[model samples]
Target: MARILALDYGVKRTGIAVTDEMQIIASGLATVATKELLIYLEGYFKSENVELVLIGEPRQMDNTASESEVYIQEFLKKFSEKFPQMQMKRVDERFTSKMAFQSMIDSGMSKKKRKDKALVDEISATIILQSYLYK
Candidate 1:
């Protein structure tokens, strides 16, 4: 089976995660600059067989779209245009960042290490993928 990838989109950076070839075991792949995200994915797709991509959908507590969704929507349009054949889906991403932070604490990560925003993004992407898999 082809791998399924996930992204936790941020303004400055984005987190990436992917499942194994068997479509199991979601794992953190990278934290990349948001401005360079498309180029990075293009390179990655050349080496990987990703069948579907899950883009985190930022939403508020009331289920309304988040303010940052305008940015995400713009990225989505660009992505769809760049890779028209590739499939993409948006999975709700509410609280994933907070969850990722708590996860760092649970895993006994150092305070200094937990302060790394990139690490948090990567972990958030992993959590988003894992949540989708379980659901």
Candidate 2:
């Protein structure tokens, strides 16, 4: 079975996560600059047997689309064009960042470490993957 990759797409950095072939236990993969994502993904797809891509969707508190949806929609369109054969899905990402921060605190990470945006992105990606798996 092929693995599943998840993305927590941000304006600057894009968080990445992946699950095993069985699609369990999502783990943080890396955080890359948004501008470099496509190039990086091309290499990744060439190397790994990834079957699906899950992008974090920013939704409103009332379960409606947010302003970020516009950006995400465009990104997904381009992403689909670039990886036409790859399957893509969207997962709601309402509080993944907040949850990532709280998880860092619970894990006893130092304030300096917790402040690393990359770490937050990594956790966010993991959250997205986990959500996808449960769904």
Candidate 3:
């Protein structure tokens, strides 16, 4: 089966994750500059059979769109236009960042490594993919 891809989008950087061919496990793939996301995806798609792109959808405590939602929506529009053949979906991303941070602490990562924003983003993407899989 084709793999499922997930994204944790930010204005400057984006986190990426992918499920295995069997779609049973989700793993962190990479963290790329937002400007280069399309190029990265192009290269990835050329080698991997990806059936869907799951984007993290930010929301507030009230279940409404957060401020970052606008940026994500804009990115989604361009991504849809660029990869017209690929399917796309959104998964709620609430608390993923906090969970990622807690995960880092649980793993006993160094303070310096824990400060790595890219790592947090990557983990968040993985969490998003995992959530989708379990759902």
Candidate 4:
């Protein structure tokens, strides 16, 4: 099976994760600036045989869409237009950031390291991907 990709999209930075071609392991890939995402994705897709995309859906505790929904919808439109053959799934991302931070802290990461939003975002994306995979 081809690999699946997951994205934790943010206004400043976007986190990326990818599954193994066998669809078993999900690993953090990279964090890209929001403005550069489409261009970056174009290159990434050229090199990787991604069969699906899982986009993190930031939701409130009440299961309502967050303020970023507009931006995500715009991205979804572009994503669908570009990768019409690939399927896209939305996975709730409630508390994923907190979980990522906790994981980093539990790993004994330094304060400086913990301040790296890109790394945190990448890890969060991995968590989101893993959640989708096991569902």
- Give all TM-scores, in the order shown: 0.99, 0.96, 0.98, 0.97
TM-score for candidate 1, please give it.
Answer: 0.99
* Tens-digit lDDT track of model 3 for 30-114: 9999999999999999999999999999999999999988888888888889899999999999999999999999999999999
* TM-score of decoy 3: 0.98
Winner by lDDT between candidate 4 and candidate 2: 4
Give each model's whole-structure lDDT.
0.97, 0.92, 0.95, 0.93
Candidate 2 per-residue lDDT, tens place, 35-58, comes to 899999999999999999999988
Best candidate (score: lDDT): 1
lDDT ranking, best first:
1, 3, 4, 2
lDDT of 1 by residue, 1-135 (tens): 999999999999999999999987999999999999999999999999999999999999999999999999999999999999999999999999999999999999999999999999999999999999999
The lDDT of model 3 is 0.95
| Candidate 2 vs candidate 4, TM-score winner | 4
Clashing pairs in 2: none
